[model samples]
Target: MIPWIELDSAAIPGETGTLRLKRRGDEFSIMLGANELMNSRLSGSEEALAELSCAKLAGRKAPVVLIGGLGMGFTLRAALAVLPGDARVVVAELVPAVVKWARGEMAAVFKGSLDDPRVEIHTGDVASLIEKSKSAFDAILLDVDNGPDGLTRASNDRLYDAGGLGRSGRALRLGGVLAVWSSGPDPRFTARMEKAGFATEVRTVRANAKRRGAKHVIWLGVGHR
Candidate 1:
């Protein structure tokens, strides 16, 4: 077995703990204390977060998408693969260290997705962007923290609350998609989405593409027109 090596560690902005970047051979992981926030090898659900949401905008021209987290760049890369050439993708990452890890130690994991012509990196809170915009995105994909029951920061809880769901709905265009990736299910989250005027579907997906990993949840909500 290959030994895991700590590449670097960085404080998670306002969080008390720091994120540790570890590498084992070709694999990489981002850990917040004991909780593994993301892993390069387990990206099935994260990819689905973008795939499921982008599927909702099949006919829209130059659709704009906002991705709330850039963990391992799985969602962003997946979105770029299926979205039209003219479409734009804005990725908001709260921790600057995560961005540095993408460009530095984990560049291969990202595969140049950061430099894609249609993508932009916002080094700030995704919530702020959601609050400042109205009907600004065709799809809003969130893979922040550990879903509704967060781990990294208490503030992340806001992104799953009723008020946050309302903000997400307002940020999206009518009939647009709001896709959220979670480590597990939260029935209350589904209810919140529905109350926020979105027709919602809860899906359980395997973490790995081989379909042999932990069951992760993805909430696909289409904003009511």
Candidate 2:
């Protein structure tokens, strides 16, 4: 049987230890503590997020999209696939190591998203970017932390909180959408979105199955900023 091999490592601010990237053959996994943040085989939730978020920006000018995390660049690649030539993507990733892994070791997995002209990588907390931008994005896809219930970073809770959602609402242009990827469902987060005045929809998608099985949830929280 093949075993997981340590391929790369990087540090995230506020994390107790370094984030490790491991590989078993062609597949890869991201590890923080004992948890597997994500794997290469099944990025359905991320793809779903990019798809739904981009749907909201159809026909918008320049169509600026903000992606809160760049995990393997699946979401970004998916977004770039559907977005028009004039569209632009701003990705905020908190961990510099993660960025390095994506640019260096994980480059093949990312499929050249880093070199795309429309991409702008910001190495910082996504919240700060949200707070600083003024109605900038047509879509905000947040894959940082594990949805509303964060596991890797305690500070990520703010991104799922009402106050954070409010800031995200303010960061988008009118009729923009906020899509959040979750390993599981959170009703309270949905309620928070409702309270923040978004027309929300919960989408369940499978990692590989097209018909539906072993599904993951993506909360599509649509709002008019």
Candidate 3:
């Protein structure tokens, strides 16, 4: 068995914990403490997050999409694959190292999604971006933290709270969608989306493309017309 090689480490801005990038042969993983934040081998659910969201915006010309978090670029690449050629994708990632890893050691995993002509990378809090806009995006895809429960930063909880949901809704254009990825199901979160006036659907997806990995959850919240 090949031992995992630690590529690099970075301190999560608001948290004391450090994020480490490791690789075991072709597989790569981002770890926070002992928890695996994301793994290259398990991206089915992430891809689903993008696919389902883009599906809702089918036929919309020049759709503007915002993706929070750049984990291995799975969601970004998936979104790019399905969106119209003229669509624009803005990726907001809180950790600079994650972006660096994508361009550095994990370049192969990202497959040039970062360099795609339509992509714009923002190095800051996605929540701030959400708050700064008013009906600006056709879709906002969030894969930040583990889920609504959040593990990396305490402030991440705001991104899943009532105010956060409200801001997300306000940041989206009419008939827009907010797609979120989670490690597991959260009943409270589903209810929150409804309370925030989004027509919501929760989907259970496999972690692996082969369809035989731990189940993950994705919430698609359509903005109320």
Q: Which model scores highest in TM-score?
A: 3
**Ten contiguous residues minimizing lDDT sum, candidate 3:** 145-154
| Predicted structure with the largest lDDT when compared to the true one | 3
Candidate 3: C-alpha lDDT: 0.93
**C-alpha RMSD between model 3 and the true structure:** 0.8
Better of 1 and 3 by TM-score: 3
**Model 2 quality (TM-score):** 0.95
Give lDDT tens digits, candidate 2, residues 1-225: 799999878777876766889999889999887888888887776787898778877778789999998888889999999999899999999998888889887888998888999999999999889988878888889998766765777788888888899999999888889888887888888899999988999998776525444577888877855
Q: lDDT by residue for model 1 over 20-67, one digit each (tens)?
A: 999999999999888899888998989888888899899999999999
- Please give the TM-score that candidate 3 achieves against the real structure: 0.98
**TM-score rank order:** 3, 1, 2
lDDT of 1: 0.91
lDDT of each: 0.91, 0.86, 0.93
Clash count (model 2, backbone only): 0
**Model 3 lDDT tens row, 1-225:** 999999899998888989999999999989999999999999899999999999999989899999999889999999999998899999999999899889989989998888899999999999899999998999999998888866888888889999999999999999999999999999999999999999999999999978989999999999985
